[model samples]
Target: MKVKELMTKKVLVLKPNNTFEEAAKLFIENGIDGAPVVDKDGKLISIITKTDLMKAILNKWKMNERIETLGPKKVTTINGEMNLEDVLKYKVSRLPIIDKNNKIIGIITQTDLINNLVEKITKKYRDLKNTKLSLMELDSVIECSYDGIYITDGEGNTIKVNNAYERITGLKKEAVLGRNMRELELEGFISQSATLLVLKNGETTTIQQEFNTGVKVLVSSNPIFDKSGKIIMVVTNVRDVTQLYELKEQLQRNKEITRKYVSEIEEMRTQLLNTSEIVAEDHRTIEIIQLANRIAKVDTTILMLGETGAGKDQIAKHIHKVSKRSKKQFIKVNCGAIPTSLIESEFFGYEKGAFTGANKEGKIGLFELASGGTIFLDEVGELPMDMQVKLLRVLQEMEVVRIGGTKSIKIDVRVLAATNRDLEEMIKKKQFREDLYYRLNVVPLYIPPLRERKQDIFPLINFFLTQLNKKYNFNKVFASDALNCLYEYNWPGNVRELKNIVERVVIMSEDDKIKRLDLPKNIIGSNGMVVTLNTFEEGINLKETLDSIEGKLIKKAYDKYGNVRAAAKSLGIDPSTFVRKRQKYINNIDAQYKT
Candidate 1:
């Protein structure tokens, strides 16, 4: 090793003007033997030690002269930049390292050289021990790991290898070593790759490839250099990443196993989302469910357009749970919920004191936190016009400029935007930028309102009842009459409302079996009142009103049963009535009633 390589980069020094009293204190505190002395310009001239000081003190005692004059003659000075051999050949015991600007950077003593020798020998011993351990790996283990461990010469000649290396080359290590890598060359350059790409390019690279032996490996190579800085060897380590990769593949396989699996072990969480309880029988609802599966497969931006409280967040999470980004964070932000004044910071981030009451240590926003993943922006159309400009800049630039920060930080994130507001109307009013809308609407996904998917209602209700059973530790079943009442009412709050209503009925019902009386009072009165009014207003008969009421109740049952078919079965009404009602009044129904 070169002397510079062995030497410490950080050194100690003393100013020439400092008296021995001051220098002695530093030496004692640092536990070093000596310090290099420099002039006002910090130029290295000489080094002083306890021995040198003693020599000066003895000389003064002998000649009765000032010791300052004796200091120059008694000290030995060697150039610090010179190799160790030069100093030893000159018979010097000390070195004074000086910069081009003449600052004294270090002092090297004979004692320091002896200490460095001990350190070098110890390091060499450890390295040799490690090599011995590597050679003895076979004796210590039953089988080798999938990773290929190999060594190559300066000219790229194979020297040593393990079982993994033999497996990767389709040849035994004994048959390959002492041979050039040409003997192990593959037919395809891009396919069966090597860990030596870094060695070939004179830089390190971690890459994935299929080996010639038909195994996939993730490989890394580190270059080894000789004293002259020439490339002498390369040590490559590879791990078989096939099993790990397959697990990832398994997780991303968003297929026909399409039943929603929302966790509801907690109380508040149970009331919030209950997709499985929604029974949907309409063919359009099935189409949307299939579409949800398709959306989960793509990484492109998804724009969700629908009325509020229609299970948009649930759909967004469903998409995330089935996508490639499922393992990463699924950050949610309501553009409308953020104050206009703090919108930029909420989305991009901000520096310390970026504004009044700003976080002191700086905070990473959803965009940064969502990097390497996805962010579901709820009600994206509600973003203020000014923030829209900033968001558009980020989407276009693929970077974010934090509030009060000059530098822009790039991020890799898939955005999912959901909104109840009609973006087209907002665009018409110039409240939302059309350019931004187009950028976000890369893959448009429409989550039909609950009224449209009324078939999904009953299944949802049943699912919620089971969920409530688990929560309150009570068994509760819906009676035919109660189920009928639920089916008849208009759902203004959509699936969210239905789930809460189911949970409320399960918990509040005095009897084990739910009946019409246990149904929410407003729903009971409103369904009958509307039917009575229509019967009188349209000069319709009681039979017509009963048929109409049955249609409405069947649609609600469809929503509760998680589809229309099951609800029709429960109501003893034809399934087509649920389908017709959903298509017939979906647009006019209040969104709040459905949720």
Candidate 2:
């Protein structure tokens, strides 16, 4: 309880110049031991105590015939800031009440001070009893709590601790008490944020930690302050939160176990999200992302066919993430990127002497690393027939035979294949295997080429633009003309090409928003003749249309390669294309129905 809560509202007073006789009589009339002298403004001037009044009256204010200077006239003063200790130190009969302006407002008598002391003493006894009771209750609860408890002095030295603390910290009560908290959390059990706050602000703090046994626990403490606003002690509360935390960890572990048990082989699944990383996006591209999410849930081999910039890898990753294998490994292997000669060795394990400079300690292949997981074979069509045979064996036997090793390791795995090639035609021409085709064609998914997904072009551009902006912290946007230029042009490289273009645009364009003048010189109101293969006037006879398309394609192929052999080879139109054409012309087969 506060002293003010029990203090008297009224007090006695006398003018500073009042005679000793006047002070004595006022003190007597007030039935008090002291009287506060005040000025005309009712502000405190001096205090006349009983003893001082007695001295004054005894001398009769007459010393060598000097009435005003006979007895003690000066009075000792005290401010309200003085606590019980300060009052005791002064040994004064009265305590002065001073305003912040340094003028004494009133005085408190010795009797008033004694009255406050009596009340405080009474309250302290009650508080001590209450604290003892609370401690007993705490002790009772601590015996059974999963967490240990500790009581520390204001300086953060432990004074007491529960048995749980003994078990958790591996420290006895005798060892912990009087020990600083810093020593208790050597393993960083207590958070620095919490520690700093408690030290600086003397506020309560709680933190989570992992003990040596790996059990998680929460430690909390609050400061106890004295009437003088000094912290006297801190009581700490500890509770174990390990059960819940461990449960979550166990569930994740169980998932890994399930993945292993379900698939004895390694499967590489790449389910990439367009928004999954730092990049740009146009509207059509965003739609593709949403579509990819829709396809991810199904476990199937998705064939992503698109130009280089269409983000096929991203699409692949998106599919894997949406499928049940989202939690497993999503490894990526770029067939186009790997060396052709090393492709077989990389996909399937090699014998110790299979090749020069191979690791002496039989190295683990990607297929092995992706055991019970995923291994993305990006640009899969690049595999030569030799590796294709090995891959076929893996699919057929569900096992792997390491190079130089005779043992065949069986495995269960899912396969998701993707390529930018026209595999169907490759199969017809005997370039790609038919068996492999059937195996990989379990669920065929195609990423619509960029141009056809026109809706995604702008949004994809903007997405890339925004990516560049955030990455570089630049508030860059496209100019109206620049945007129109992008929309008007054909994106041959697709999203990848657009991103590079956007990066170039951001660096070259100067205004807050790119303007028409800032647009690349490539497409400025430009109507350069665009010779696309898509244009047509009307429907010709079916055979005529087929012949026309075949002739145009053959011519384009010839012009590009400068001869039939080179054109056929460049167009992958083996003897098959010529042979098929002969048969088609003979049979009068229409080109529109060619596929």
- Lowest-lDDT window of 10 residues in candidate 1? 52-61
lDDT (10s digit) by residue, model 1, range 121-214 = 3343245325544322432331355667766655665555667666664546545455555445553422633534645776666777665566
Q: In order, what is each prediction's RMSD in angstroms?
A: 31.6, 23.6
Candidate 2, residue 362: lDDT: 63
The models' CA-based lDDT, in order, is 0.62, 0.57
- In candidate 2, what are the lDDT values of residues 430-472, reduced to their tens digit? 6678888787776666666667777666767777777778976
The whole-model C-alpha lDDT of candidate 1 against the native structure comes to: 0.62
List TM-score per model, in order.
Answer: 0.43, 0.41
Clashes (backbone N, CA, C under 3 Å), per candidate, total 59, 38
lDDT value, residue 501 of candidate 2: 61
Output the lDDT of residue 78, model 1. Answer: 30
Off by over 4 Å in 2: 1-295, 351-354, 523-595
List candidate 1 stretches off by more than 4 Å: 1-282, 527-595
